[model samples]
Target: MAVRARAARTGVYQYAGREIDPDNTHGLRDTAVVNVLRDESAVFDERAVRSFIGKPITDDHPSQPVTADNWRTHARGTIMGAMRDGEYLAFDLMLTDAPTVAKVNAGKRELSNGYACDVEIGDFTAPDGTKCQARQKPGSIIGNHVALVDRGRAGSDCAICDALPSNLFDTLKTEKPVKTMVIDGLTVDMANADTAIATVQTLIAARDAATGKVTTLEAQTVADAATLVAKDAEIAKLTKALADAKPTLQQLRDAGKAFAVIEAKAKANGVAVTDAMDEAAIMKAVVDKAMPGNTYEGEHVRIAFDALTKDTKVDQPKVQPIGAPAQITDAHTDYLNDRAKQRAALSSAWKTPFNAADAA
Candidate 1:
């Protein structure tokens, strides 16, 4: 069988660790042999065909750096065996097939994993009024309302909701208009807190009544309600305070002054500030103003660079060195003069002189 022969020769043969033979263990079938016999002209021209025909085939070895356009066509079935059924093949292999494989892969990955929604349930409806479904995707048709489903099992309904975003489910649970609110330092227009509170209150009330301790819970509920009222009053007061404090020039100046004070403190402590402040210039200015030049003036004495470099005038006459008087003896002076003449000539000749020169 031509297929069997080709597969035996080419499938998965590794010079190193790289799979050379791309076709799986299944070699050429009888059909391929029949095709080759039927179309001798086409078969003769193909390089893969020549290799199969037992001719001398040139195997241009593959490397990681080789260009994809020039990559050898590998066996199709063999590649499938290496990868998962549904998972994508890596671009490292596909760079040979299509140079844009990476881009295509990126698009596919985005479609598969990136498009997300936190849909909130608005309502549930069914034809029979028995089985109902809630649309809970946040930006979906309906949002932030509870969908009452009568027919579906609670577990199934909950599971379906779980498959949706956590945020959407949470939003649905707290279904109402999102009023602007602050928690910690962050500004948020979150899901309605009132709806959530009412829902919780209703649940608690129902549970207490069913358990026959409604009267006992009544006292706790009153206490909780009082506490909540106090909290609301406090929040309202703060909100009013914030609202009253409108942006003014004076307020801005006060903020700037406060910032300056903090900045000064930071600089004094040698805290590293950003380039916005020009720390180098500020430091130079500080040095120039606070500790300019190497001069120290104490309480009793003043010291400065002028004191060191200033010219001093002496109050006494200059004295010359006392030595023997110069008396020229003809023999000694002439010998010295001759020696000087010879030394000068020698000095001029060599461009330098030794300690003593030869006397004429």
Candidate 2:
């Protein structure tokens, strides 16, 4: 009988009393021979024959092997169960293989609908000396298994975990949503409803101010128009009154001619007329300064006196003087008679002289 060795197991397998899987197995299969050296010098050496028999390992074994084809499905099922059990950090499916990680990522991407899922892969080492890559929510702690972010519901630690402060959870539960409005295609969130209402009121106030200014301007324009109308009416009345009071040209010329005659009469009478005196005053002064007979009343008195005293004869005659000649021219008559006698005597003497001369 020859001694024989049994074949080793490679993949996951089940035996009669135990189970073997890839988790506990390693190394490939190869053939080797057992060699024994003999020495003939010693008296005690003897040839020995042994008979050994064992069952050969066969492919007739139950296995649940993890491979690339079904690793995603198994990993997803495992992670889902761990999440439900609150043991989400226990498994590291990301470090298994590239294809397995890809499948896992795809499944994670499908978890959040219409939103981007930010799943973080972290390096971890299992207790069994295997390198692992685990999936977790972004910014999450390892042991808490809940996200460390401040969502509206206090993340996943509000109800059961109690990892946050007691007052913080109460505040989050009672907080109200912010007020929002859409302006020019952008959403604006206000602190409160009062703030949004105040903005609207500001706009209304500005519009009212503009309207008031326009109204004031219109009123001013109307007032100015009324004032202009009143001024035009007053001007028309004054123009008519002036036309009624003004003197005509012919009347002024006649008054000037009458004044010239009065001035000339006053000058001829030496009445001392001046530019300051009017026509009636200068004529009155001229009449007052006239000579008594040259006055209008004096002329009538003189004419009556002349009519009474005219053509009256004397009442008495004078007697003739004693021995006086009846003619009053006697002296002149005696001188003329003496002159005639003298002439006659001279003529007679002249004739005698002539006669004597002729007799001689």
Candidate 3:
């Protein structure tokens, strides 16, 4: 599994410069210091000693061991004077007993492309339960550890040192912000910042347009669904109306038979029936002619006609009465004689012998 680096704390001031530590409690007193302006022989000068009782030695002087009496007079005076004068010169802290030259080389090795050495500035609680200002500069391992540079005394503040910017803007001003951008497998060198920004804007505009088109399609789909629902409702209404207006099978059969009877009656009265005449028209014509000189209403006449014809017998082929005897033919007489002979044989008490003559 890969571990992601956590974001650094906020409100922690950062400086892209060196810092100075005056504390000698961590066995860092013998750490070598150098004077940049002097020759190699003056690198370990007495004034470069780590500190004289928590104070930095700024001026080169003869070597003198730190004593209780001189600690306050010499070491404390020099550092306090510098602070009062507002001298915010860059300084280095003897944080470890490592060789000074090696540490410097290590700091240089940690510098990478597009990055610079920086220090994180913040307040820290000292062993004496007092708040002290501290500076943490990048070590040789970059993010692994940091070298602490503490200002002498608690509550000592340095606004100028803590206000340095730690971003890459200063370094990038002399170089291009971006080197290359890969688009569709094609590498494009971002030589101009304006052109790169314009490309991003174009991509954003196209995405917005496509999103708008998708939204429109969704809206159209909803509208089409509503239209289908309305059409279904209309079809249902039409279906019901058709069911109410059209006659059923049984109703059609009854009306057709009644019309047939009315046509026959019209024909019997010497009236000609035509295909153009419907049941109502024929009934009206017949009722008017049959009831001539009578003040009978058409509705009453139709009712009487229907009642009279309701059980009227239909003409059928004549059939013989069930009690009438059937006429006998020669074949029937022979059949009767054969039946009589069988009855006589059955009635006899003795069994007859089988003979061809008897069969004849």
Candidate 4:
């Protein structure tokens, strides 16, 4: 075969305006290192190489060694050995055992197109009538256990077991039952096919039993029930407290009326009574309005009242007269005055009106 003239001793060449010398030793290197940029279909062989370099080499057009890009396709078969001389830079190309690369490309394609092949299942066997170990088409079968190997395929150093989909299994179940099997160089049991079937059945039963014990939905229902019970208990406790306090609230209502009467008298006199005023304000107002004689000013009110009536009932209902006001303005004024007097009197009292004894 006619070989192309070897590249310049410098091995450094310009391509697309960029100077490149592989490994930076162009001065010592006698041959050039040129990359192959041929498409997969380009044929590279002896005759192909001669045809490419038919023109005579010249000063302006020096002979360029056959780089992988311009080499005949067949040159790939011996590219590895050719690298020893550094005469050419060609890729040692082969498609054998390249499933991982295929898988990566397939993932990219799937992501771009939003489509994927459904998984298939089936039993795979080897050429020697044995099961092949997992490795591409040479490895796992996608959905079915069946593999289709065309004639003259190479690279049988590794094999593998591929799981196929159930649909494919239904179709291939009667295909001679795939008699040969291998697990890491171990043979399948010859007389224990029945045991294998039983083992699968036992595993199925155990999984079902586990699924029946506690389900996600059931757990959610249990949590909801606990929350409802707690809320109902809280509501019932509040209801009981309100029921127990009803009578005491009613008693305070009755006692608050007598205080309101005294408050009305103080307001009628143009005095600005306040809620902060104590029992002293009430006694003062009563003494001022009554303008009691020396018999009352020097003497305590309790003693004067006691002398006036010995049979006075201390616990008489002290309801304020309902005719205190007819209009809203009058009612508001009455409320303000009454609150002021109540605050003062209650402040002076040893106990608050809210206390149990005061309510009684």
Candidate 5:
């Protein structure tokens, strides 16, 4: 509860006329706080001033209003009347209640004025170059009562506002600086600029990280494609090598069989053959032994082999007689071999040169 004073020039209350320092510990505003001239005019208006005149003074404000009906029970004095005193609207009062006068005479003399008003909230510099957050609007000020207290807010010197600032507002809103943000061509209202900026920065960092991952994946894809191409080329090369080897393998098998025949013919012709002898040397030996006096190119050695084997082929039986059995008998088998020389000559016939074309 704010207090007031009882004095001759400064009785209980005044309007306009309240001043609070910016550096005051109350922390009301950032500059000297005062009422506007227009609001002062309203406070001193005939109806407003009359409402204050003759109002009761109490030891302290009652819980309810002290009207004419209740003044006898609550009044310690009376706010007799008021008038303009320089920039201030000063009041006069009469202390009629004995007990309250005793308290004041006993040095408890501070005063408080109780009033009602509709506060108009704003920030503005006062006529004396002070700042205030609010002032009483025109025609909205009315006097209720005055009270004597231990301490006064707006002293007789009018150094503070009269109304209880703590209860003046319907809802107290602690003001914070408003900030704005622009996103995708739209403006957004924000309570904190620093937090918004930090959030945007975090989002940008996340986007960059995702972009880096995509770039790495793209590069990896290209490398994988190149590796696949190399693998395909290697597979193609191996396939071609296999294809080129097919005919060479057939030729190698044919040459090995030809040499085996030459070695057989050389032994049959009584030309000494040894493991150390190659196909060409064995062929020459066979030719020299069979022709006895001829010296010929290596190709002529085949004539000697044909001459030696001409009499060796077994002929088919003349024609099976009507009575002959379909399965072979010992007599038929006997015609296939000279039993006495079979063991010695069998390898020669079995290793004979094969004609792949005739078999196919």
Candidate 6:
């Protein structure tokens, strides 16, 4: 493994370009002393930098050293987001367990890193030009976990921060009163005032457009409901009318059937009915065809039509055809001869004179 280069250090951390304030009682000799122990700085050499970069963050240092086999059971979260704040490695701790988060929020602010290294007791100079008695072997440093504690080995300098130091933002020079707005639960703090205003306006316009579409949908729903009510009322009225007229329909059907039968019988017997005739006219024609010369009126026409029903053969009445006649019978020839002799004797008596017949 190659030795890695470390970041430069200044032996103390500041609230960086911000004004210093005095603490009431947080256990510190000075107000801004983030001391990284000037003489014994070998703990943060190049070996420590590589080993501690991606270590896990825990509530407290476990009794046993954390390893890959047991890290899952011991790890609350990782502190891989380590930034070198001078000689002290400033890392962010996010406890995965709810109880640990509550404890940290309730004033557990200090952090201590648990690591193993081969310390060679000798007169040696650290990479930052700080002379020290114990020097850690370049390849013998191994990081386990950075733990939250009541007080760290490095004092309050290695601690959890409630908020970022104000000096991190060099853009606070603007005189815009430092505006802050929230969009969908996200706080929007920008460097430029004009950019912030434009963002707020665009978000508000999108919200208003969504509200308008919701209103349109609600109005369309009401209109569809009203149309359904009117259609239901029309259907109900039609259904009732149909029910009320049901009683008379059977009688009308029976009359229609009888009329059809009479018309059919007349047509079969050589009568042609046309649409020009009404019901009564057609019935009268039917009666005339059946009886040839008889006529009926009033209710008697109906009675005559009923009598013809018992005999459908009235439609086929016998009649002589116009063709050569057949020979006459013997009885019919004798009767014709007797009628001629009587007519001859009556003529002779009249010729003998009425005076001579009286004297005899």
Those runs of model 6 whose alpha carbons end farther than 4 Å from true positions after fitting are 1-47, 123-133, 164-360
Which should have the higher lDDT, number 3 or number 4? 3
Writing each residue's lDDT as its tens digit, candidate 6 over 275-360 gives: 88766777788778776776456555776666554456433234678899886769778888888898888878767757866798
Error of 5 at 35 (Å): 9.4
Model-by-model lDDT, in order? 0.31, 0.34, 0.40, 0.34, 0.59, 0.58
Question: Comparing 4 and 5 by TM-score, which wins?
Answer: 5
lDDT of 5 by residue, 16-65 (tens): 32233222233444444344334455556667777787566788767667
Q: Give candidate 3's error at residue 109 in angstroms.
A: 60
> Which pairs clash in model 3?
19-91
- Index of the highest-TM-score prediction: 6
Residue pairs clashing in model 5 are: 3-152, 4-111, 4-112, 5-111
Instruction: Give the Cα-based TM-score of candidate 3 against the true structure.
Output: 0.20
* Tens digit per residue, CA lDDT, model 1, 222-250: 44553565577678888989976897888
Give the C-alpha lDDT of model 3. Answer: 0.40
lDDT (Cα, tens digit) per residue for candidate 4, span 210-316: 75554434434444553465567667878998886766866777657756655554555444678887545655654554443433433355333333334323444
Deviating ranges (above 4 Å) for candidate 2: 1-192, 247-360
* RMSD value for candidate 6: 43.8
The ten-residue window of minimal lDDT in model 4 covers 108-117
Q: Which stretches of candidate 5 lie over 4 Å from their true place?
A: 1-39, 156-360
In model 5, what is the error at residue 325, expressed in angstroms? 99
Clashes of each: 10, 0, 1, 36, 4, 0
Candidate 3 lowest-lDDT run of ten: 1-10
Give the per-residue lDDT of model 2 (tens digit) for 252-344: 877776676656656655679887898656655655554332333333333322232233222332466688557556888999989999999
